[model samples]
Target: MKKLSLLILITVLTFSCGNKKSKSESEPENITQVNPAENYSGTASITQGIATTITEDIYTCDRGRKTDVGEISSTDGKTWIVPAKTHYLNNDFPFATDLHNSCEGLNYDTAEEALANFNAANTITIDNDGETYTAYIFADNYFEMYVNGEPVGKDKVPFTQFNSSVVKFKVKKPFTIAMKLVDWEEHLGVGCEENRGKSFHAGDGGLVAVIKDAQNNIVSSTNDTWKAQTFYTAPIEDLSCVSEEGNYRYSKNCSTEGGQDGANFYALHWETPTDWMATDFDDSNWPNATTFTNKTIGVDNKPAYTNFTSIFDDPEQDAKFIWSTNVILDNEVLLRYTVE
Candidate 1:
C-alpha cells in the first residue's frame, strides 16, 4: 500500500509539470512583421504584437520607366528629385537670341522665371522665430525650392498632367524660402499656327504653396496677402496677317517695325530688384498677388495628383491660378511673399 501511494504521488507531480511545459510551448511570443506595398505613395504605420512601422519611396514619370531622377526613396530618410530640365528655346532667331543674350547672368527673383519666356521665379522670407515647418509646393510646369538660400528640393518632372512636392526644414528666428517656377511651352512661341487651329496656343503658368509647423499649424500659404511681381513676359510680337483668305494667313516671323494693329502685344519690361530675396528689401511697391481659382479641368482628373485636397485645404485656395491678363499670352510672372 505504501509503495502504491508513493507511485500515485509521483505520477500526479509528473502530470502537473508536463501540463506547465505544454502551456509554455503553446503560448504566443511577441513578434513584429512589416509588409510594404510595391508602389507606396506615402508613409504608413502599423502596431502589431510589438508595434512597428514600415515605409518605402516610389516615383512615376511621363516615360513610366524608372529613371535615376524620377526615383522616390527613403533610404536616408531624405529622398527627393530635382526638377527635370526642358528645352524652352528653338531655332527661332530674334526670340531665341534675345532670350539667351538679354536674360543671361541676371539674378532673377525666382530661379525658374529667370528666363524671359514662359518661366517665373520668386523668393519669400519668413521669420519662423525658432520653429519647425513643412512646405507643400507645386507648379503647372516645374519648380525648385530653396531654404535659407540652400536648395532643399525641386519638382520631379519639368512638365506633366500635374504633380507636386513636399519638403520639411527647421529654422530659427528668420529664414528665407525661394522658388523657381517655369511654364513650359512645346513650340517656343505658342505652337505653330499651321498645326492646330486653336486660338489660345500659349500654355498656362501657376504656383501654389503652403507651409505648416511641427504642430500641424498653418504658417504660410499662397494667397493675395503675398507680394508678387512680373519677371519675364514673352511672345510679345503679335502675329501679323500675311494673307486674308488662306490657311496660312498668319505669320509669326513678321517684323514689328511698322505701326500695325496689335503691333505691341503689350510686353512688360522691368528690372529685377537686386535684393528682392533679402529680408530688408522694400516690397511696399510690389502689388499684392492676385489669386485665381483653379480651372475645372485640373480638378476633374483626380488620379494625376497626390493628396490634392489636403495640400489645397481651402476650397477657395484649390488650384490657385497665378497669371497675367491671359494665361498663354502672359506666360512668365514673378511672385513674392514675406512672412512676419
Candidate 2:
C-alpha cells in the first residue's frame, strides 16, 4: 500500500544511516569521524533510502504489538539508561561519547575540558568559506545530521539510550540542514520498547536544537517552521484514529495506554524518498513540525538536556522541542530546514 506517500524533487546527503559505531574509547579526538554517506556503496536507486513496509492487524495494548525481532531484552531490561545519577555533559555533547554503551553522549571532566573542546579555538572545515557554528541538539533516541548536502555527523549511539550532541560545523550562509531522526526500538519494526513497568511499553521521542555563530548569536532552532514527516508509527490500537490531510499525518487520537502485552499490535511504515535530504527538496507542501514542551517530552529530569538549558532552553533562543504530531507513537521522522 502506498499509504501517505508524497513524491517531490529534493536535492543531497547519503541516506545509509546507522553506520557510525558506538564509542568504546576515551579519546574521541583520536576516534575517526565516519561519513554516513560512504556507508552506502549501492547505485543511486529509487529505494536507496526507502523503508520496508510492515504488516499486522490493529491490536489493543493488552494484546501486544507485532514484532519480528522479539525480546531484545526482558521487561525489566527496559528502563531509561542514563550514565550517572547527577549532572553530566554539563557543557554540551562536544564530541562523540567515549562510553559508547552508556546513554550519555559526550562528557567533560571539568569546565576547562569542555571549553577547550568546544570554544572558539575549535574549528570544523566542512566548507572552506563557511563560518563555524555549534549545533546544540537533544533528541529522544538518535539523529544523523547533514549540512548543505554534506555529512555533519550522526549520533555515536543510535538507539535505546537517550543522548544529545553539539556538532561543530562550518557552512556558508543559505545552507540546508537535513536530519534523520529515529526514536529507536527494542521491539524493532513495532516501535515499542520495554520500559517503566510494561514489557511492551510504548516510548516517546522529541528533538530540540539551537545553532549559534562564533559570537553566540542564534542562527537557527527547531520549531514549527521546519518540515517534519513520520516514516514509522506503531502501537496503534485503531487505524481509524489515524488520518491525513495533505501533509499533516495525524495519530494523536490513538491510544497510548501501553499494557504489558504488545505482541499482536499493529504498525505502519513507509518508504523514504531518494532525495528527501537534498538541499533543494521542496517541502513547502509538507506539514509544519509539531512542537512539544519539556514536560511533554519528559526531559525535566534528563541531565543530557537540563545541563544545556543555557543554549537549548535559552529564552533568547526560544528553541522548542519538536516531533511528528504524535511523539509517543511515531518512531522515525525526517526533519529539514534551510539556514539563510
Candidate 3:
C-alpha cells in the first residue's frame, strides 16, 4: 500500500501568521548571503559572471508539504551544495509562547566555522535518467553557492515563511553537492512582539530543490518532512483474531473493527516470538490500541507496515499475515507512531 509519506518542505523560521499584525522594525538585515560564483566540474558552466544558487533543503516540523530547490551552477559544471541554518548570528530572542523556547534548534555560531564545517561534510550525489530524478541534501535555514572551492551568488536569504524562497540552480552532469546552514534570526530578530522575554525554540530547518532545465522548465521535485532533531515513537494496537479450519490466521477491516470516521489507523504484522505462543501471549503485557494517546488523529496517511505473527511457538516456522490500514478488531493490531 502507498502511504502518504512525510516531507521537510516548510521552514522552521518565524511566521507572520494570524490576523493581528505585530508591528516589527523594518525587516532586519538578511544575515544570510551567498558569495561570488566560481568554477566547478559537473554539467553546466558559469560562462558569464557568478551564478549563486540558493535552496531550502533543511528539515522542518511540518510534514507532506511542497518545497523548492533553486537552480544554480559553477564555471566547471561541478555541482555545489548550499549550507543553511536557523539563525546565522548569535542573537537571543523570545519564544512564541510562555512555555519553553518553542524554537528548539537555532544558532549556528561563527558563520565561517559553520560554513567550513558544512563544506567539509560529505557531498550529495543525484542520479536520474529514466523517470525519477532525485538529489539529497541537509541544510538548516538557507543555502549559499560555491564551485570547486570558490563561492558564488548574492547574499541570498531564505524566507521565514513555511514554503517560500525557492531558488533554481542550473545542472546537467553528475557532481558533488556540499552545503552549510545559518541561523536566520541573527539578522531577522526572533519573537519581538508578543514573545518578548519568552524563550523561542529553534525551528526545524533544511534544504529544498526542484528539477528544471537551463531554460527554466520544471522536470520533477521533492517534498518536505520533519527537520528538527526530534524523534518519533510509534505506538502499537492489538486486534485479536480467530483461525480458520486448518489455518491459524484471519483477516478483517479496520472500519468494521470499531474504527471511527476520524480514527487514525496504522497496520503492522506481528508474530509471536519463538519463546512465546498465541496461547501464551498476554495481550495486557504487549502494546495495545489504548497505548496511543495525544493524537492529532484523522485518516491521512497509510500504515508503514502490516502483517501477522505465529512465531511465539516456533521462530523458524513460516508465519504470515495480510497487511492493511483497514484493520479487524480481533484480527490484527495497529501501531501509533508518535514524535518525541
The alpha-carbon deviation from the true structure for residue 28 of candidate 1, after best TM-score superposition, in angstroms, is: 99
Q: Give the TM-score of candidate 1.
A: 0.49
Query: Which candidate wins on TM-score?
Result: 2
Number of residue pairs clashing in candidate 2, backbone atoms closer than 3 angstroms, sequence gap of 3 or more or interchain:
12
Q: In terms of lDDT, which candidate is stronger, 1 or 3? A: 1
**What lDDT score goes with residue 139 in model 3?**
22
The per-candidate count of clashes, in order, stands at 7, 12, 85
Q: How do the predictions measure up, each by TM-score?
A: 0.49, 0.68, 0.22
Residue lDDT tens for model 2, 1-340 = 2332322211111233344455653336655774322332312111111123342221112233222222122122231111101111223323332212233335543322454555543445667888887787777766777787666656655554455666778878988888878776655545667778887678888999888887878999999999898876777655556666766677788888776766555555555677878888888877789999898999787666776677777776679999888899887788999989
Candidate 1 residue runs with Cα over 4 Å from true position: 1-129, 173-176, 189-200, 237-271, 302-306, 315-319, 323-326
lDDT of 1 by residue, 107-149 (tens): 2233123223431122222333556666666566555555654
**lDDT, candidate 3, residue 306?**
9
What does candidate 3's lDDT look like per residue over 156-266, in tens digits? 223232221212233334322222223232111110111223322212233333333434333432221111110110111222222122212232221222211111221
Lowest summed lDDT across 10 adjacent residues in model 1 is found at 93-102
For model 2, the superposed segments whose C-alpha errors exceed 4 Å read 1-106, 109-115, 118-124
lDDT of 3: 0.23
Model 2: lDDT equals 0.63
Question: lDDT of each structure?
Answer: 0.43, 0.63, 0.23
